[model samples]
Target: MARLSHTSLWMFMVFLFSSYCTAKTVTYDFNVTWVTANPDGLKERKVIGVNNQWPLPVIEVNRGDQLVVNMHNGLGDKNASIHFHGMYQNGTNEMDGPVMVTQCPVPPGATFTYNFTVNQNGTYWYHCHADYCYPDGYRQALIVHDNKSYFADQYEEEFTVTVSDWYHELIEGIAPDFLSVYNPTGAEPIPQSFLFNDTLNSNLKVKPNTTYLIRLINIGAFVAQYFYIEGHNFTIVEVDGVYTEPTEAEILYIAIAQRYAILLTTKNTTDTNYPIVTIADSVLLDKIPSDLKLNQTNWLEYNAEAPHPQADITVEVASDLNPHDDMTLIPHDHMPLLPDPDYTITLTVNMENLDNGASYALLNNISYTPAKVPTIFSVLSSGSLATNSLVYGEFTHPLVLNHNDVVEVILNNNDGGSHPFHLHGHTFQLLDRAPSYGPTFYDYKDGSPVSYDAFNHTAFPQYPMRRDTFVLPPQGYFVIRFVADNPGVWMFHCHIDWHLSQGLGLLFIESPQQMQERLTIPQNHLDVCRVGGIPTEGNAAANSVDYLDLKGQNAQVGWLPAGFTSGGIVALVFSVVSAVMGVAFLVVYGLSDLKFKGKGGGVVEGSQGEGAGKEVGSTTVREAYRDNGDEVR
Candidate 1:
């Protein structure tokens, strides 16, 4: 009878826990405003709340619940919005809520409601959609806890470690002139100071004997920055917004745009104050020779604070999980995952037109050229070559990686500037780097020697790191790998505001199905183009023989039907012109040198000997184009 009673009680408790896990309907309100209190004041002063408090209040909810968040803008000057990162929910596109992406900004005295569901269960965050120039105080943390039964015995306390960077400029409204700002030829350095949860100087206190889960997020700009608990080692169990096979480290370097959830149990140490966390600022081109000097215009000094070799915080050890003990915590099983393909495309950073009046840096061979018109019109218009033609140097267009392909990218920075290149929708592994760089295989290029340069390797014990966004240091490159398992038209671009506006971006389409589902080419978006099918006659009706061919044919360059007169064709024409001009000039110069040099005659002088010589060379170019059936411009 007692056994039966115990079974009944167990079933009843399970039912109650399941009910709690499945509860629905959660609503939250976030208000935005400006305050004028002096934080540096020595005396007590009243500090006004932008919403209703500082550091904002915590948001708590459970999985599988409807979430409706209303944002009120009281910040008299600018628009406002909120974005919940890494959450899956209905109305994802609508709820993406970036100020200009899906909805308009909330002007002063206005309010906006973001409605969605929390279908994902894990640690995630919510922050203002303002430009990167905004202050750190504007962002906050959010927790969607698992029902107690889910981790009834595993979880004890949750500690949110929201890392941030600080900038004195107005980050949000600094755009519209982004082109001017990120003009590769510009003179300004990107911002440098960083913080933890809006505090330039604050720390998290903990007792020695407890196991604490630390949710680490880099809502900042630098990539490959290492965070270390100097006297302690911990295990990393989750990356990005998902769980991972546990990895351990004392020093951890994270690529920009990534999140890691680490579990650390502190152990007691002697009464001496030991360093808990130390951050080492990364320097681009770390392997460069000390005496080497690139042109002043081609290299910039690393401006972040000197690496924090000294731990920033120290506290007394209180429990069995002491600062002195080494620990290992691995998840029981690996998460189920899909397979991917293997192909890598490298984005090399280099400079051109050296010493020329208008020299600029190039990714591949494509220069950063911002659209003269607004992005909205660029999205809608057909005549703008800048918007329609997706160019990646001399390489192929619309880089199509098949679904399930193991894709890797090497962002090689040859110029002096550092760029935080961000990929949308997915996170990637740092893999291994060139032997002369750092440690760990989390980041790597195609085939660097497995073993070399052990001296510098030991310095960064936390590498190769896992990250979503990583910076390409000046004249250096970062290799990142990931499975191209997600299907979509994902945007891969530099996170630097100006660089992105200036065309340092490209789209990576995963599959044909994904391509068709996501793409709305210039021709497809216009009514006239859709009606005519193509500019050519005789292929435009249901009964026409030509129409049947069009219908039956697989979509390819040949199936394009050749008569569209929008941006695509115009871009092709420009490309052709550029190519022909280049070849003509080269041939003319080559032949002239061959004739004048006479085995050893000076080729340079011969090509410029007389006006007639120059004119003859020009005439050859014109004749060459005429023979190719093209008119010389």
Candidate 2:
């Protein structure tokens, strides 16, 4: 009888503990609109805001809680959608936002809700995923608190630091220059200033001898930044929502859409404060203006009375500062390298002019183009043909995957610029990359690209790192692997907003049959599509009768005629006409001498020379067109 009473007491204690830790639902109602704010103190411009406020609210939730964000697009002039970056939306793919990838963009005055279970925990962010929308300040940090973290007991408190690039003009004004022939090289617009936590020179008051967890996120649309703190080093514990084994680092290179969590223990003395420096990567700029400040300084205040000195300049350029290679970090779970992939997909990144003569990024030969129907809807409504990649449209670059198959992707860059590639719905195991961060990172910048030789390359690590976003070296290659366990359409794209605009992206239709069986999109999402005049049924072109027939599907801008763009063609035509007209004038002048000589009955010696001059002019005109033709062709 006594033993039975002890067992009942133990069971009662377990039940009380579980009841206390029960997860609750977190809900937020957002009214998205336009507001004005000057974060960098350089200029005030229109920025996207939530609830009539500019610095959008940071979303906070604990792991295992339910997150529901009821978003109403109050911006009468623009469309918007929120993408919870780095979240693996597992079975809820319809809520994975990317304009037309998962759901339609919420139209003006329309309401849409993103409701999902918070199963993962770490530092993350939520931002507008629609084209040219997030850059206008529709981003905020989304933190998922994990009481069960290995390092949770190490820190007394936590802080969120956001590094971003600020622009004086809105995305609408900047889009014309980036997507037009006037800026022929597709040079990304230079930001007016760099921002630290949505403002400038802000101080974080810290108590000496206290350990704090600092979450670093580059919430910018274009430029990445180098982050460091003077007189202190921190241990990195998490990256892109994945808890990694604690590693020590003094400097970190944070690209756009990337996040890192570090444990920073303050010094015992409160005699002085330290400067936290953020340097914009200058290599991304086409032209850095003299007045445009690239380096920004914030403070870690140990004492309010102590002077906060400016940071000491250490490097000649941002590239000279070598950051720790993130590919080497091991995950806390220590998930081993996935076995030889059941499938492999290989492609190259090329920056070339399309038929419009505007520069575009391409995977293989196709640039990502949107479809009339959201891809997730297509998968749900396509019946048994959902697994067919053809239904997703040619320019969407659809690749189908079977359920539970291990997939490998090889990405080779032919361009000289680096790209931070992000895959939605999964954290891929980064197996191998060439020309890693260090002195030899840029050795292939001007030379032939080093492609990943599957059979001849370095051996894969026993325990490879995993992250949703990974940086691809310029003119180098990277190989990653992941299991296609999720059943939905996921987009794999470059996180650089400009690159995505130029069509540097693709779609993966994973286990579409399962999606058709298990997925049911909300009716409100369908209503928004109707309001936007977007069809939600059938294939990409909206042919519900035949899923395989994609006749009217959206396609990318056609290829330029080998070395010649439409702009070049027009210029050539105008030059040719101008040359012909000039030749005609010379010929007319050459005959002037003969006409006068016949009328006056007087011989002119220069008539022969004038005739020769006409011949020379004719030859010059023909040669000019010929030379231009050669160059254009």
**Best of the candidates, TM-score:** 2
lDDT of 1 by residue, 555-601 (tens): 11111234533244335545665686787677557756654444565
Candidate lDDT values, in order: 0.47, 0.88
Candidate 1, residue 316: lDDT: 27
Off by over 4 Å in 2: 1-21, 565-633
Best by lDDT: 2
Per-residue CA lDDT of model 2 for 243-324, tens digit only, reads: 8999999889999999999999999999999999999988878777889888888999999899999999788888888887
Per-prediction TM-score, please? 0.55, 0.88
Tell how far residue 366 is off in model 2, in angstroms. 0.9
- In model 1, what lDDT does residue 267 have? 63
